[model samples]
Target: MDLEKRHEPPLRQTPEGCLAVAIRIPVRIVVLVLVVPVRMVWDALVVVGRFLRDTVFRPLGRALSWLARAVFVWPLVALWRYGVVPVGKALGWLGKVLLVIPLTWLYRQVLTPLGHALVSMLAWLYARVLTPVGRAVAWFLRGTGLVLAAIAGGVYAVVAWLARYLLVVPGRWVYEWILAPVGRLIAWCARGVLWVLEMLFDGIGTALYWIGRVLFVLPALALWRWVLVPVGRVLAVVGREVWDALGHAWRVAGRISLAVGRALATLFRWVFVEPVRWAYRTVLTPVGHVVRDVLVRPVAAVARSAGRAAREALAAARESVRQARADFRRMLLGEPRRVEALDRREPTGPETRTLGSSTTALTKD
Candidate 1:
């Protein structure tokens, strides 16, 4: 298995050189050194930004949003809800009363009758006045068309006789007897001349093609194959290796930056966070507890007690006032009669039913 694995083809990779190897270490080192401080500062800025967002900016945003709503949105909403909506409704009612009702009445009483009368008048005019004029015009155009058609037939006959004798007969005789022989002779001579020219041009083109091939095409091919291809290959390899090196260096720098960031974070946690947390826990927490227990709790308890007593006194006074009002009302109007409830929930009456005391026709006590 080991031999087979060793014999197996390796993965295909672009070749690298000593130059790439030489560049990699220095570039990564320089990038790491440059990135560490930036990463630390970035992390610090990120932390501060988060702290500000949570503590300051969030509350400010909420307050600003509330203020904006109170200042702008709420007033607009109130105007729309209270002013615009009521006015719109009133306008709609007025439109319905003033415009809609009046227009509807006018349309029904005035316009509809007027439209019917106009339609009748138009129908009468079209039937009585315009129809006969149109019929006469059509008849006149029909008679004129028939007369023009007869005149056109006579003109066409004269033109056809003149064309056949003077133009068609003479042209046919010239084409068949004289022009035909001359045209055939000219075509035959042109064919022979074209053939000779074609052969001559073919020979010239072949010679030129071979000359150009030897002069330009073969040399260009040789240059492209031998010179440009090798040079381009070398350039492509160098470019690819340089790009790969940059990517590898950037990744290495990112790792270094992460390590430095973590180290700084640990240092900050120990130096600043731990001490502050310790002070808050050891000193401030106990002080806060003492203040809350000694001053705040007692004051809160006293306030709560006073408030409860005040509420009780107010409730008692309200009850007394209510009773006095009731007594005075009773003195003026006497006591009101109380109605008895008629709805019952029980199946039997006050006493439980027994067989001996049954009130049915079958059994009675």
Candidate 2:
């Protein structure tokens, strides 16, 4: 039996081994029952997720992106390219044709010619009327200035000559004729007075010396040496001691008071003044500056602009009124009437009498 068992094939190669495999078929059945449905459900879920991604989510995402681009970006691009750019170019072309070209032509044709005509008229007026008038006035003024200078020179010469004659001649005559005798007489009188004064002063000084030696000098020396010196020494010693003690106490008290005053001042400044100063500098000052700059300055500027505009309007109104008055007058009366009226108002020769007199004086000079 051992030989037959050893010579037999392995169980896997035998028919009974097939029966043992059949006996364990419940495990395979259980594995297939549990795992196959789970795998199929997992595969079905994956297929559904892929189908949803491709069919619903991806298309929806692409549609949303396309809708955003169409709604927001395409209109703006189309507007910039087709509407705004074309409109801007058309406006630029219209401006160049209507405003710039016409203005340039008007300036070159009408305004430039008008300006040149006005300049020529002004030049003619300046040359014909103003030039001669200015030259005549300048000549008159020059003659007047020359006459004034000549008169001033003559007056100065006369004054100088008179001064020399009056002062120098009189002074020389006085000195030679009257002052010499007077000065000699004064010298003689002064010498006599001085001699008398010298004699009197010498006698007086000798008497004063004797009187002071007896009455004042001896008493002053005795008083000072005997009484004043001892009293002064005692008083000086007592005063020095009192002054030293009082001065030392006062000095110490003054130092303490000064220290306390300084400390109090520092504390007061730190507590009160610094905060107020800081608040004023940081808040009130800036606010005041802002009010001045932002409110006051703009108001002043606006007022100035309004005043300038009003003045210009008033000037234009006045000019219009004057022109209207002139036109009304021209319409009411003939041109000859205005000319005759101007002629009647013109000055005759008598009106220039002062000027003629000045001219005559200038010619004479």
Candidate 3:
């Protein structure tokens, strides 16, 4: 591919209307004039805010965090670690001693035996006395229940025969022979009435549905399709155009502001910075070099020479003091013993140890 084609932007080539072209130039020009100062002011504020955050706000926040830790967090931690923890442990020990130990002792030593004795007594009573009495009472109740059951069976048989003859047979005969025809006629009439009501309600429902369509649904649909749709489309077109204009103007204004800022920077550099830089480079640099070579070097050399002489004098004085100290020591303690250095090594190999000489045991002193 060609370089120009390869480097070309990948955006779609959508065409705008005549309205957009007419609006764009004026909008961008007006926006540039309006937005240049605002953009510069915004950039200045951003720089200032960053500076404050770096130099002032960040440190302030860190200091606040440290102060909070020292004032609130550290004291609370110390209280929990050193004060509350020990107090809680002491209270726990006291509870174990005064309450828990005594309770455990009572449960183990006194209450356990008492509970066992009560359980044993209850068991003995149940097994020895209450069991026999309950058996006797159960036998008596069983005998009485048999007698009552016989009496109840006799009464139930008589009542069953009477109910069959007097109530059940008569009710069955009346229901099958007399009432069945009337009930069937009534059911048929009810079915007809129900079918008629269903048909009537169905007609009413269809009518109501048509009425709702005419009164509510159709007009609303017409309003949406005819009036609202066209109005919304027009509004959407206007809004899209306005938004596009705003974006285009903003980009143009940014470029204009950037150009203005660069021009101002160049002007400032030429007016103020270049002269100062030239003076420093051409005039002040030479003067400073001359001063360093003439005045400063001579003064430094003299100071260094004086310092060297003082150091030599101090070194001589120190030597004299050392000799005097040595003489005083010799006069007080008398002659000192001399220590002769010796080399001691046991060689195990057939090699010369020092000065190419043998170190064998056969070669005695």
Candidate 4:
């Protein structure tokens, strides 16, 4: 039974036996699992209580502190406001007056008179020169515009008169005197040239006849004597055969040449007419799109960019020129300026005499 019990399970101890028994279980671990956790919870509650006390009471303490500060410092605040703020404001005013003194002195000494003089000068210039210049410019522009308009109107009138005259009388006169006469003269000349060409052709025919007689007839006669005589005698025996052969050959060559000429003419017509017709339908019909996208659009863009750049450059140049003129005038009217130390001074009389002698010697040399 003891062996079975030992083998089966260890019996649990009672509370008194557990207290008396020595075991490996740790008391500190027991306390940590139960008593320590309860104590930690109690300490956490205490900490929470202290935290609440501090949090809930801090504002009151601060209020008391603020109340004490108010009771102590209210009079001090009033005193400081009366003493320091007014003194500070007075000092600020004094500082502003001190700051203004130099500015007032400068205004009285230089700026006021400069301003008045500048205003007076500007007013005088406006009255004396500017008004006249503006009036003159306005008049000049108006006159120029009038002149341009008159010129344009005159040109339009003259053009209209010329057009009317040309359409009515001068065109007819030109047709009669110049065009008709010239055409008649050209026709007459062409007829004369045709006659001359006919005469020349007749003369050339005569010359060719003579040349044939001189160059080919004798030679042909000689060839006939040498070769054709025997051949002719033979051909005389077969005259129909020879004539048939020659006629057949001539007919074939003529047909071939005619066929070639007709083919060439057809090819020329196809190349010049058919391709042009097709291109007119396929490519040339859309030529306005090409012009707008390729030629006209790019040209317009370039013109706009160039015009903008040119206008900007001209404006900048005009401003630069105006500023240059202003600077030149200011320099001319400005105070006498000190010369650069590096610049040579004018020679005294003795030095100039010596320099003249040296120059004369140099020239002589």
1 against 3, candidate with superior TM-score? 3
For each of the candidates, give the backbone clash count. Answer: 0, 0, 0, 0
Candidate 2 on 101-203: residue-level lDDT in tens?
Answer: 9999999999999999999999999999999999999999998999899989999999999999989999999899998999999999999999999999999
Give lDDT: candidate 2, residue 359: 35
- Model 1: lDDT of residue 127: 100
Query: How well does each candidate superpose onto the true structure, as a TM-score?
Result: 0.56, 0.25, 0.60, 0.22
Provide the lDDT at 252 for model 4.
Answer: 51
Kindly report which residue stretches of model 3 are placed more than 4 angstroms away from their true locations once superposed.
1-45, 173-219, 247-365
Arrange candidates by TM-score, descending. Answer: 3, 1, 2, 4
Q: What is the lDDT of candidate 2?
A: 0.81
- CA error at residue 363 for candidate 4, angstroms: 99
lDDT of 2 at 43: 50
Query: What's the lDDT for candidate 3?
Result: 0.88
Which residue pairs come into collision in candidate 3? none
lDDT of 2 at 204: 100
lDDT of each: 0.88, 0.81, 0.88, 0.76
Q: How many backbone clashes does candidate 3 have?
A: 0
Candidate 4 local lDDT, residue 78: 88
Q: Between candidates 2 and 4, name the one with more favorable lDDT.
A: 2
lDDT of 1 by residue, 156-192 (tens): 9999999999999999999999999999999999999
Question: What lDDT tens digits, residue by residue, belong to model 3 across residues 1-365?
Answer: 57656575788988977766666667566656676677767766876899999999999999999999999999999999999999999999999999999999999999999999999999999999999999999999999999999999999999999999999999999999989999999999999999999999999999999999999999999999999998997676667766766676677666776787689889999999999999999999999999999999999999999999999999999999999999999999987988985665655456647665646677633
Q: List candidate 4 segments past 4 Å from native.
A: 1-87, 150-365
